[model samples]
Target chain A: MNKSSAPRQSLGELLPKLVVAPTFVVAVIFIYGFMLMNAWLSFSSSRMLPKYDWAGFIQYEKLFANDRWWVAAENLFIFGVLFIVICLLLGLFMAIFLDQKIRAEGAIRTIYLYPMALSFIVTGTAWKWILNPELGIQRLVREMGFESFTFDWLVNTDMAIYTVVIAGVWQSSGFVMALCLAGLRGVDDNIIKAAKVDGASMPLIYRKIIIPGLRPVFFSAFIILTHIAIKSFDLIIALTGGGPGFATDVPATFMYTFSFTRGQIGLGSAASMMMLMAVIAIIVPYLYSELREKNNEH
Target chain B: MNIKRVLIYSILGFAALIYLLPLVVMVITSLKDLDEIRSGTLLSMPQALNFDSWDKAWGAACTGVSCEGLKGYFWNSVLIVVPAVIISTVIGALNGYVLTKWKFRGSTLFFGMLLIGTMIPFQVVLLPMARMLGFLGLAGTTSGLIMVHIIYGLAFTTLFFRNYYISIPSELVNAARIDGAGFWMIFHRIILPLSIPIIVVSVIWQFTQIWNDFLFGVVYSSGDSQPITVALNNLVNTSTGVKEYNVDMAAAIIAALPTLFVYIVAGKYFVKGLTAGAVKG
Candidate 1:
């Protein structure tokens, strides 16, 4: 064999090298790098200053002991479940209804989606005013000669969290509807025709056939919505500030209160860490299912 | 598309009105004077339409020492959101490119890590990220807020771009390689051009995320550096001061104008952008 014609091993070697090396470098430096740094800070006696002295799970211990932390965690579960389920059902309903080839579909679709365009701050304040008992719907209805109609949920201790859920669902469901609408549009009309030929009612066909087929789309929407609800701070902060005496408090608000409002850095970090853990606990399983489903499809 | 369809649309139309009721109230309230807002129904039209509250909200509303309305905070928001959006999206693109084209050892682990980053609530990262910013001597500054946005924005943007790139054929990367293009060159020349839809998506998402941010802005900025969200919160959420409902509504509208404008102007694109990687992949 001629020496030069030994087929240039450089190309083959460089292929993996070029593709692999830079990726490893960037991921290590940027993604996991910051995460590890955060994890390390959680372990230290760091407050305003990040001293690397080992606190040995002291922060984690205190995190569980805190009442506010517990409340925040509890609120997360409530808010997450309520928001996700409502948005999913409402989104699916809208998607299914809109898929019925109704007139003015485009205009109606835009109307639904307009809320996602506004920031949470806008949504929060707008809804806050609309829900305010003294100035909003309750007051409006009462003044209209109905003395018994009360919609004071935004201000009520027990009901404030539900108000957050309501606003949240309103703000996000349109986008979810859009997502499901795209998925619905992707469904083959032949499937619907087949169901019709088999004497299935529209609602029955949707429950039996269309829904089963839209699993991947529904899962995608669920993952996105759940993540959104987990990381929810803006809507809660803007709407209630976790207030009416911590009634609407979630992990985000709890972390914020300790970290910024009270200036209890160590306790704040503990709350923060707990929140991170809770979110991961919620997200990991769903993500695993989604990933597994994708692999199975392939 | 007959009488039955017409009835269905009428029901949807009514539902759409209910969905828009709060916003309609906000707009109607924005147009009314303090007196009308105090006495008149929110859904009802103003007795005399007035722009005085809007004028005050945009320029004359007091937030601390500044009597200037939300317009004063406008530049600060621009200062924060512009750099925050651009930097975060660029990093997202790079991460997406690397994750897709360069499948290395531990790439799955790294991707998993990014997904975890997305899942972790901002509340959880609040203290540590704040402390980290303070340690870097960047806390309570515009730059600090931008850094926070970048970190928070990273996971979602990366997810967006990664899903988007998945739709493009792997051969694109191989072809770029065969042409002897470098990583940045391939991304800029090939991937970026095809990424307009996703880029729009990220931009819209980031704009809403950063612009609407309250807790981060509140904790990370003070006085002159406060973004409009914080200022608007203060204006409406005064601890003891009389709540001016008209001004507050006006302030909220003013704060939201920029993002809302972008949405309306690019309304078609905004809707499409959100649904881009949602289904086909």
Candidate 2:
């Protein structure tokens, strides 16, 4: 009986491992494996279809020289900086404002956050119409006797990317607000009371005490916003279609157009590698700190 | 103090209006005739309420070669979202159960690897994924889309379940093990029963994500197999004839309605999931 049961005990231990094995293997192959494959494709001389023949730095050379790629990268820079800054400031303000024991907070919070529930596709399309010169705000303002009031950023080459930023902030600031609100709620009330007892005004207390304590929230929000900004594809597609003529193109759309539509897989892969590098640059330090924190706690 | 009260309420009210403005325009435009949409400003109330665009957007709108509106793509979204959500959540729960309760060697390392999966951009995988899907003969199919979502979603679902299960007392598992409960037995009889809340959270979260996903849908699925988002984009951007703003608005609303419904109905769970996911990260 003891001998028969020995295999059963071992099998019990093995059962859990076996259950976890498929996910582990799939994650390894699909996620990590594809990442390496993308890196390889970026180096190969593949166009129209993937090829395995290695040609060092050729694709990256073309990627850097390509004007459209540069536009995409530039738009990403402008969009990323503005989107992150505006969302953070607005979100922090909203969170701080709502934290003032206001009434109807739930209803107001829901309204603000509803956009985050909608797809960027929906947000983009809605904004596309709202910013269209003839159909939307500009027309309304003109009818209201402001004939020179022109807000046609959706169609302008230089201003199209800013429109993307506006829609993005509209969609995401509420989410940032929610994050900051959670962080603010986590703060000890005693600290604020102590500051008050020391004769610090509300604004000063917030500036010195409350805001400083929300550093982790700001970091996490930055990480999330940066990820969204880099991966922005659908919004650009729906809102500007990366036009008047590819003016608002970001790397994701640039990659899609080249690799899939124009059949420049090598250059597309190179561009994607840059995106992956950007993500890794942001995420690795975050993961390192997160995991180290866990280790120290243990 | 009174002025402060007025200022706070006014600012909150303005923010709320800004957020609601687009949605209101979308709904009103969807209900207006094409002529009204063309003639009136976006802020104007419709002269006559009409559901013609909604009907057309639902049943007759052309997207590429298909003129079947968004109904087919909506169903396609449902098919992809349901399976992907269930499979990922179940796998996540199982993995979480083992990682937390069973505690095998290298489990944390495995988890850390999974966390890395969450951060990488989906673009990095598109080339290989397209090739692999073709190799597996699942390319441009709903099943391929489902597989993609599940693979990407695993990290998140796993994180949710693993974090939740960590708080469960492990002595129960020990007691079950001592009482001759085997691995599957303990999981089925003990762990899963206590997982209803996390399961709800995971399902709602995954459903919204997969439903709202446009990148994977556009990349992986083709033709009639397209999800609502891609279909909506194609419908709105086709530009073959005169552009119909009303139809476009209607289709956008249709595409957005499912996740919007989920948000309205189960908003508490939605916020909880978002905060939990963000805080844990």
Give the Å shift of residue B139 in candidate 2: 1.1
- Report the alpha-carbon TM-score of model 1 versus the true structure: 0.88
Per-residue lDDT of B85-163 in model 2, one digit per residue for the tens? 9999999999999889999889999998998887888999999999999999999999999999999999999999999
> Candidate 1, residues A118-231: lDDT per residue as tens digits?
777788888888888877888788889999998889888888999999999999899988888888888899989998998999889888888888887777788777767777
DockQ of 1: 0.43
lDDT of 1 at A156: 88
True contacts kept of 1: 0.50
DockQ of each: 0.43, 0.84
Q: Compute each candidate's TM-score over C-alphas.
A: 0.88, 0.97
State how far residue B90 of model 1 sits from its true place (Å). Answer: 3.4
CA lDDT of every candidate: 0.78, 0.92
Distance (Å) between predicted and true CA of A41, model 1? 5.1
Cα lDDT of model 2 overall? 0.92
Pick the DockQ winner. Answer: 2
Task: After superposing candidate 1 on the true structure, give the runs of residues whose Cα lies further than 4 Å from its correct spot.
Answer: A1-52, A55-61, B1-3, B102-109, B170-189, B239-241, B272-281
